[model samples]
Target: MARKPGLLMAQLLNRFIWFDAALQKSLDIRGHGGVRRLESMCMVYVHAGIRRPSELARLLGVTRQSVNTALRELEAKGLVYLEPDPEDARCKLVHFAPEGAVMREEALDIVMALEAALEENLGRKAVDDLARLVSADWGEAPVIGKKGVGKAKERKKKSA
Candidate 1:
């Protein structure tokens, strides 16, 4: 098949990068210094109640080591602290540092402003529909073999 312009995955990734850059730029204007995308995402996940680095790795689809590294960076920035997990001695739980509260709250407010700006540009309904579609569970990937992708192509050929 010929390549198509504006594929769904590309569009989604482009929008993601756009928002990520926008957030970073807004943070910079507030004199918060530069924050990497992964680091910022880690903060967001931590605020959402994902305490363990292992769970954060799972949610981010990254390795546990990556999550640990990001957490360490956050610790260095005084944005978060990691403590020994009470339930599991081998694990550590993430928490926002006392000094980090102001920055965290400011980042959240920036996100809300970004969303409001999106709604202004795209309309509230469009933004709501985008959120709903992106959040909806689409299930697992196809097996893609003798009975999967090949069969799909065969059906497509017949329809054509």
Candidate 2:
């Protein structure tokens, strides 16, 4: 059965939540303790070089305060630390601690295992094609104006 495009994102989110649950279970067994979705997301963004809290909030569609709170919890877990941004001392940047890096590597291994399991059920080509399609640049998201007109928003630079 063909799926509706509008529901695709929701389906993707559901899949991600399933992955998150599996990840948390594995981490817990490995003594990483309970890691919230937001904290794990923060780690992924920071690992990808998005360090500023404001930027993380924007990407996550949450408030800066929320991002800060999650960061604080992560710090308490000894997974990450907030350091002064050299470019702007007034702002703090997120960086993974030594232990955090190790943890991330372990999580990545888990992800690989999950992907392998998916392949076992869905075939290797299907999994590879899904990854390629999602990773491809699909251009900008649409901006809907009043009267139901829609237009693509220009791509913005990832500057901090």
Candidate 3:
């Protein structure tokens, strides 16, 4: 018997969803003050120096509107603030407020602890390998009407 083409991807996605849910619950219990998962992710990107709303949306693979909504929530919670970008008059940059900086540190510490737990569960070597695999460049994305579709048609013809 053969495994499905998307089996690995499906499994990884399912695990990530469950892991994110657990992480959210853990953060809530640790007094993170009811932040949503998207808000937390946006903060991480801001901490990583992605300041522009458009850039954050691109990095998170979400729409700019969604990022803006998350930013608004974070701002309401006193976790983030938006300031006019000096270089670009039309855009605003996202920044951590004083409280948000502290929250960012706590979030990072929690993430590190989770990584350590993963290492313990999967072994250091396996965890390292998985990290390497995930971080490696997989080349450009495939386009539906381009080479990918043509290749699929060719494969189908060959099989038929």
Candidate 4:
């Protein structure tokens, strides 16, 4: 199927990266240090309801170093902040600033455009069916992991 259509999953995914990179380029064609990749990626995670950098890395299938670079760029762009984790003093979490929220909203519009293009190319029903199939597979995975959403364990109760 892939060889026939020249659209293997990896190649298709590369196209998305290329598309995103171009979109980012058009957004601000300055340098590689622009407010595109990180903010764009952060918007995806935030839109998907995942804010933590740790979770973002896993969801994006990127390394922590890659995520860290993106986060730093986001910080420089005033799109995100690292707040001290109340639950764990030693840890920290990322949150969207007011401007970040605005950025996210704009990013969502861009995402919608991408989705519309995909639906148009793949056929709306096919995209919808693909979404359902992907969701079904995703539902089987637990939320927490060493590199995912982190440990979701409840606090231990005292013995009576």
Q: How well is each residue in 31-96 modelled by candidate 3, as lDDT tens digits?
A: 876888788788778878899999999988999999999999999999899999999999999998
Candidate 4 lDDT over 40-152, as tens digits, reads 77666765678677788887888878887888877777777888878878766887777656555655566678778889998999989977865675443445745555243
lDDT of 2 by residue, 1-160 (tens): 7998799989999988988888899988997767899998888788789999999999899999999999999999889999999999899998888867778888989988999999998999999999999889977666664534342222222331
Query: Residue 24 CA error for candidate 1 (Å)?
Result: 0.7
Candidate 1, residues 1-160: lDDT per residue as tens digits? Answer: 6768769789788998888898888888998866788898898898889999998999889999998888889899999999999999999899999988888888899889999999999999999999999889976544465676557666777999
Model 2 residue 12 lDDT score = 92
Candidate 2 overall Cα lDDT vs. reference? 0.87
lDDT over C-alpha atoms for residue 155 of model 3: 68
TM-score for each predicted model, relative to the true structure = 0.83, 0.85, 0.82, 0.65
Which residue pairs show backbone clashes in model 3? none
**Candidate 4 Cα RMSD (Å):** 8.3
What's the C-alpha lDDT at position 108 in model 4? 59
What local lDDT score does residue 138 receive in model 2, on the 0 to 100 scale?
Answer: 79
Q: Return the candidate ranking by lDDT, descending.
A: 1, 2, 3, 4
Ten residues in a row with the worst lDDT in model 2? 151-160
Better of 1 and 2 by TM-score: 2
Q: Show where candidate 4 strays beyond 4 Å.
A: 1-7, 29-33, 36-39, 138-160
Q: Is candidate 2 or candidate 4 better by TM-score?
A: 2
